[model samples]
Target: MLTKAAFALLLTLTPFFALAEQAIQSQHSCFKGPFETYQGWVMRMASTLKKFDQEVFSAYFPESKFQQVQQTLDCVDFVYQVDGFNVEGYYLKPKLAVDKKLPVVMFNRGGNGRGGYVTFTRKLTFQAELAAQGFIVIGSQYRGASKHIDNNGFDEFGGADVNDVVALMDIIKQIPDVDSENIAMMGWSRGSMQSYLAVKRLPNIKTLIAVAGVSDVHQGMAERPVMEKVYKKRIPDYENNKQQELDKRSVAKWAHELPANMPILLLHGDKDERVNVAHSTRLAGILESLEHPHKLVIYPGDNHGLTKHRQEMISEVVGWLNTYLH
Candidate 1:
């Protein structure tokens, strides 16, 4: 027999499950926004996820990337409060002469462990390229990295990750130099999911970019044998809760909900070993079917991070942002 709360929970989750089954059936279908539930609690939870994502983003990145914008390039450390936790991140802003009002670029790093480190900031060797082009680059950090515990909660802080970028934008608006209207976000791997989903929920974003990000976590895990091994090592029953969490975190499922006219770019490598190229391939199909404004670029002989053509990737990313953001 189910308790009252358990019964209520079931009722709340019923639509999502039904929708998931429908999605699986179609193999290719349009993603609609969240269905209104009669249960107020569930609605509150979804609303909270969106608000929490925004607040956590604000609290985690409270200031500009640099403590002093004396040099042409510098990384600044900041903190934002999320669910009572202090989430830390690095802000990388470019200082241009004559005080240029630069477009803002948000960086979402890869992996659950990756954070505001300079090394993982992508090998886009043109670190100063964005600045040269007059853009304020913000590198955000999600939960479970650097003093934060692993987010074992359902949805894996997916909505909260979206909030982080939005909050960062809030911080930028307060800054003296950055142009709030021309803002874009780009992420690789885990960070790509964060950026992609954030844009879906919040369409105020002007530009979007994802690199080597998987459309479905289950498919991604299936393709990468090492990830399965990793899951098994960490949790003997990886198929249990981990699967649930990944489903909640995947961006491919939610990207279609994004507004139709937003400029979005997808980049992937053919020979990637970590995350399959199918992630982007499948995503492109969804975007095309939905008739969304998006461009998918496939690179040959590139790996997980697009390391083979790092410079080319950066040039393209900066170029994309320039077209939309600038």
Candidate 2:
């Protein structure tokens, strides 16, 4: 009984109605902003939640402490297009600045999938602790992370994911206040692997600080079975080309490729269950063999990330950055 024009109108409205329903169900917020402070779940682009691969893990943060800390620092959530994908990250600056060109620290996060994505609380803490020390701090969610709606697809581990960090460097260089020449890298756990790959490729890196990082992919896969499964799922030829793919990720096998002048500060905890202390130890041996300038510090009675010696680790990291990057 409907007229032809009415039938056409109904068809046109059907997709929009379904889209509206989907948006409501997924709670998608198209938030692209120059935000004043840190906020979690800030939308990266005008995309539906259905487009993102939902993650199961949720980071537990002490909101009150983070709120207090964030008040002292200035932070913003920004996006940069990399390889045709919109990557979300945080940029932090100290409240007080003494120099026009401040040194930069590219903070590489650990973990794959949702586990490693930078949370709102993490952003606040990084700003308060690191950025407050008069350095510009940049951290990306990378690809396959839950924070960004359009992540780089699946976890490439240390493969193309390294480009995300490199792209962040390019993004930092464009910022007028950042000291592009004086750049340092700080990576923890899985991020250390990314850092190792990145440092070998990025010549501008003045110094490196790798904390409880996985230096050997084979050793890491043997230690963490869960990671092996994740890698197999993401890597195309992982089943047949296991060792080859792993060698590409491991730094212990290719320490000589790193710039000789680039000083590295290796920090590890003796009690690190997540990533054994031997990873750093073995890499240190390789660096020494290669006569690469580096320092390896193994903390006693500390877990991964040195949670027990948090303050001491921060002090050492800041000192190392000042000594080398500054």
**By summed lDDT, which 10 consecutive residues of candidate 2 come out lowest?**
22-31
Backbone N/Cα/C clashes per model: 9, 1
TM-score of each: 0.68, 0.78
Worst 10 residues of 1 by lDDT: 23-32
Candidate with maximal lDDT: 2
User: What would the per-residue lDDT of candidate 2 be over residues 1-326, giving only the tens digit for each residue?
Assistant: 34667546644532112222211111111112422223343232113345543232123334354454545455655555566665566677654546577899999999886776775546655445887787888877777775437444556877777788888766676544678899998899989988989988798799999999899979987887877887887666889998898998888888889888999999999999999999999999999888899999999999986878888888988888889876
lDDT of 1 by residue, 26-47 (tens): 1110111221211232344346
Top TM-score: which candidate number?
Answer: 2
The models' CA-based lDDT, in order, is 0.60, 0.73
Clashes of 2: 1
Query: In model 2, what lDDT does residue 237 have?
Result: 88
